[model samples]
Target: MAVRQRVVAGDEVTHVVLDREWKVIAPIEDYLEYLRQEQYSPHTVRSYAGGLASWWTLLEQRGQDWRHVGVDDLARFARRLRDRGSDPTVLALRPSKPAATSTVGSAVTAVLGFYRYHAIVGGVPAARQFYVHVTGGTMQSRSQYASFLGHIGGGQDRRVIGRRRGPSTPAPLLSPQQIAVIKDDAARFEDGNWLGDLRFRLLWSLLEETGVRIAEALLMRHRDWQPGTGTTAFIEVEPREDLRRRLRVKNQHFRRIYVGDELDDLYGEYLFLLAEHGFQFDDDDPIFINFYRGQIGRPLRAETVYDWIEGFKRRHPLLPAEWTPHWFRHFHATALLLAGIPPHVVQRRLGHQDINTLMRTYAHVTDDAEMRAAADWKMLIQRWGAAA
Candidate 1:
């Protein structure tokens, strides 16, 4: 697949690249259009587009034009990638960056999808039977490795992942004190200091209050938030189907979340601001305006929220501000849960597709739980006896 760079509208370059099967050569713009027409979120569009970009780059390296590549070529390419020490398991995870086994699978999938699309659209002869090869994820790799170990020792595979209190390894989250400090500092910024300061507040609020991915938050439109429905917070956190075929609205579910008190003032102020700007609070207009750049009134992108978080880190000195925007989500979920909210409730609030997500994310916060439990063990035993 030749990644031919052509300017679509003066200096705005569009890359025309081939998919894995070397069948469908498409300009990323076309796919983006397809995604938009399908009502896919911008984040999904960017992610798929990015994965496709990598496939095109791989195809370019192999000197295979997408118009002429076949199943054998993709298989050979896969072998070549594997020989280069690309872990099959890492490829499976499709991690974004930095993680050791991140992103190779997406690259593979991009090419496969490209080929699949081309075959369906009459761009190439039928070859789907051979082109689609699934990659390995961490869990699959672990199980395989464990099985191999058992085979070697002639014993049962006995590894057990128990949910005692926490995961063996957990990502760091911001402490409440640190989060409070971050919030205070963010609030102290005088209005009008930044172009999208108000919008930033909304973004932060959602991350802190709802524990949603910033990408999910960016995908939200005005129509998604409903006015009072008999005092229940009228909000629907719909997954952007186009951002990617897989939508993990916090890996829990695509569902509604009550904004409740935490987001009430912010929502009210935002409503007034949206009205003041002459924009209708309708379903079409994006809830978060992309005002950081010259693209005023345009809907915000996932990257835009990332930029604000980056900026927030630069401005806040009172807190351990190195935490990423994602940490806000970690802070929110654990905080909501620790504050006596049920896991199911938090899952719904965060729009998580599953309860396992909540478990996996906050499983790291067990040190405090253990300490509290230890302190109580002696007290209850002595005061309330065995029942306590």
Candidate 2:
């Protein structure tokens, strides 16, 4: 259960495990290797590994062996997860409240996945026995049976995982007023500190205007910026890997976002400043660099951006709790939807492969639109009747 940090080759740091007693309960190393082989992101690998650790710790407390675990054991673990606040390891750090449903579900799913993997590879038949074979003419008929891992059935149904959890609370977006205030504050930078100011302003404007995720924006390279046919410029978001930096896109989907002449001009200034700072202009040089004292010209990292936001919050005590870069994305999406742009177009603009995802996330906007349409239709009928 001990989390240890190790420096791998090329001076890169990776979160690795220390030899702990919990390894007896689970093949932690092997599972992590398997995930690595499957190209799972480092974040995902850490999460799954942590889930397995928590499961093993809980089972150890209950004096139960994973090989002999049953459905009842998993149910009890789920109950414990729902009742406990925070991660099991960090429970003593703060007062415990019930964990969120999504968190509980993920823990359960992780445990189930572990067992399923071990059941097939470790030759433990009891692991497969933990699932209850769902049957009958109900909607589950297509499923061979329900196991903790997922549904097991014939054809495509076989080896499917558990049902996905329902949507949680909607993510909050920044009001236009709030955004304007933030922009005004950022604009206060003068002669001595213009670099940081311009960089942040352009970053915020790009997020507000184009709605690309922060990661997508940060990973952009000089060559990714293209000159459009007219006065506009475009930023291409491509799934890329930087092994030294341990950076990559989430889903590897390619999409283009067009920027107006103003943003393009702002970027041109930023590029000029970057060159003045002695940064490289190579094709692969990150458009956004870490301007902090020692790391100039190096690519920016997530932690730095987070720290910047946190510092801004400290400066503006009245800033909303939900005011983050992601909130800007939500604001952009809602603005587009309410502006009468087709949902499909907005989906493509946002680089969402699934329209259902777009609709579900912004259902509130669409619901309001539907209500307005309904009112207009009612008014039309009433006017026609009066004329008759």
Candidate 3:
């Protein structure tokens, strides 16, 4: 059996094909369809399919069936993934190598879901064999029985499932001086790369000033920016269902964040440059346009921006390897918090649903601010003592 990857609307969907017949297994196909109907993100579906395919291949190698899998089998499956790490070649030969805790956890979750679907849609003996228990509850003398096993939270057993590692180490936050270096480099046109320069500068500016995610910045349209005719300029971030390439905002929260004059000026210059290049400034036009190939004027893809940032970092070795588009978002929040902006105000600007999330995440930055205040207090106290 081979897993074939197909791209639909810029997202990859995986299909499992069996020998000679080149047909996907009915159950796996049904599971994929089920995911689609449930509206799981295409990326998520692809991940689940890949994990299932790995599990299926493992079962075939061991001369065992999916139905025969028990707690021990799950432990072995997790161990196999750990051995595989992230090396695709090694993963193909043998799922051996210690992968990150998160990676292994996702694969196990996929297997769990696959078993769950089969258990729900019965008649398969193998699926029946996987469950060890079932129970019923009575309401008004009418009883409803359900499987107490199979991937349910209160199921047969969950001990074999791998424990995910603790929260990831926070990304390295770029200081103000470091951000200025990137902005300066991005603002300068190199070898007639006008479009690339303008796009990066605009993106960097927005990330620095507004703290919007890269997808949100790339998905913005001319109309999304409201120069509020009165008080302040702001950008609207709301989910759009009509893009050629679907882009989802992280939190799916509708928000309007104010942009300062510096960003306003940068955007103004970018718009002028776009008009100079014969691109129409329609209200629906993508705020960021492709600069290369025939895709000019189309919404820029995340990968493209990533590649540009990577190349920029290569040129300037001072940029940290761990740095990414989201780093600038951290930079934005950290800067605001250090400058004494209210946590709730920063939460609104960052589009975080809860103020607590913002404060919790940036507490270290706030700690530094407190340290500074303490240092100032010490200096003032010493001065007063000397005067006395």
Candidate 4:
């Protein structure tokens, strides 16, 4: 089996899974269409398509039917994913490292969701084995709160038999010095491409200051930037499309991020440079576009940004090998939290739909601050006792 991208309408793209004869798998396609109808993001649908494709391939290898899969079969599939990898057909010449716990969990979750959807709609039997029902339990006995409509089901509950996930790791942060090094590196004019260098610097500056996702930044237009009266400015992030590429803002919400004079100055400089190169942009034009390579005046792709970071890493061996552009985002949020910004405010800035998500993600930062406060309290008490 294989996954293929299909363009629907004019610019919108979706994914489909194909069998050996290159025919679309009906059940998977139906489920994916249901997701699109429910307004799920295209990126999310693509990921689910890949997971379902892998599951189907595994089923084919074992000569098993989707309607007949049991909990044991799912368990074996999970083991295979953890041991070998996502692609069931490709065997490594040497023992490869297992997939990450989160990857395995996502793959299994996708398969479970596929079966669950089919079970609810088409009365598939396989999904029955994936969930267990509980009818009687006190509110205190329950691990999670029921949904608002959950009481309609006669107080019954269904829970997936899922694998235990590992502990949440703290989000990685870049020090101020490291950020400075990166920005300085990006600002250097290589191959006499001064415009490209300036654009790179501005991109890094925007990400570091706003904490917006790479996609949001890439999809920004000239109209979204609003300069303030003095040493302040604002950048608006909203649901928009890039005509040249399939780019979108993730949350589909309007957000305005506050910025200082430095970034505003950088923006002005970049625009001036663009005009000097005889490239005039309208208000709705993309702010970050390719000037030096690959279809000039088009919005930059996420893959190209990743490639640039990889090349940067290779050139600068002293920098952290694992640092990506997203690290700038983590550093932004962590710095704000450390500086006593409210969690809700940070949540809004980062475009998270829920406050609990922001809290959970940065719980470690708060935990570390509490520990430091306790140490300081102990030191103060000891100092007072000695004086007395």
Candidate No. with top TM-score: 4
Instruction: Decide which is better by TM-score, 3 or 4.
Output: 4
Query: What's the best-to-worst order under TM-score?
Result: 4, 2, 3, 1
Q: In terms of TM-score, how similar is model 1 to the real structure?
A: 0.58
Instruction: List the RMSD of every prediction in angstroms.
Output: 10.0, 4.8, 7.1, 4.7
Candidate 4 residue-wise lDDT, 8-57, digit = tens:
76666788989767889999999999988977778778888888888888
- Model 2 global lDDT (CA atoms, 0 to 1): 0.71
Better of 1 and 4 by TM-score: 4
> lDDT by residue for model 2 over 74-101, one digit each (tens)?
6667767776723334446556677677
**Residue 52 lDDT (model 4):** 85
Instruction: Using TM-score as the measure, name the better of candidate 1 and candidate 2.
Output: 2
Candidate 3 local lDDT, 234-327, one digit each (tens): 8999875333455667555788888887688678878888878898778888898887654777778877887877887788996687688888
What candidate 2 gets wrong by more than 4 Å, as runs, is 1-19, 22-26, 85-95, 126-168, 188-196, 229-232, 242-246, 377-388
lDDT, candidate 1, 1-388, per-residue tens: 3333322454232334445465445445555556556654444555566666655666566576656765556655454444452433345454333322224444455555555555555545423433322233122222232222333544332222111232256666887677766566555435743234566666777777777776667667777876565686656777553222222343324677667655765776777767777765567666787554847777776666566667767787655656777888887877776676777887767766667877777766545665676787677677776565
Which residues of candidate 3, in runs, are more than 4 Å off?
Answer: 1-4, 9-22, 85-97, 121-162, 166-168, 188-196, 241-246, 337-388
lDDT of residue 203 for candidate 1: 70
Off by over 4 Å in 1: 1-99, 104-168, 180-196, 227-230, 241-253, 317-322, 366-371, 380-388
Evaluate model 1: give its lDDT: 0.57
Cα lDDT of all candidates, in order?
0.57, 0.71, 0.71, 0.80
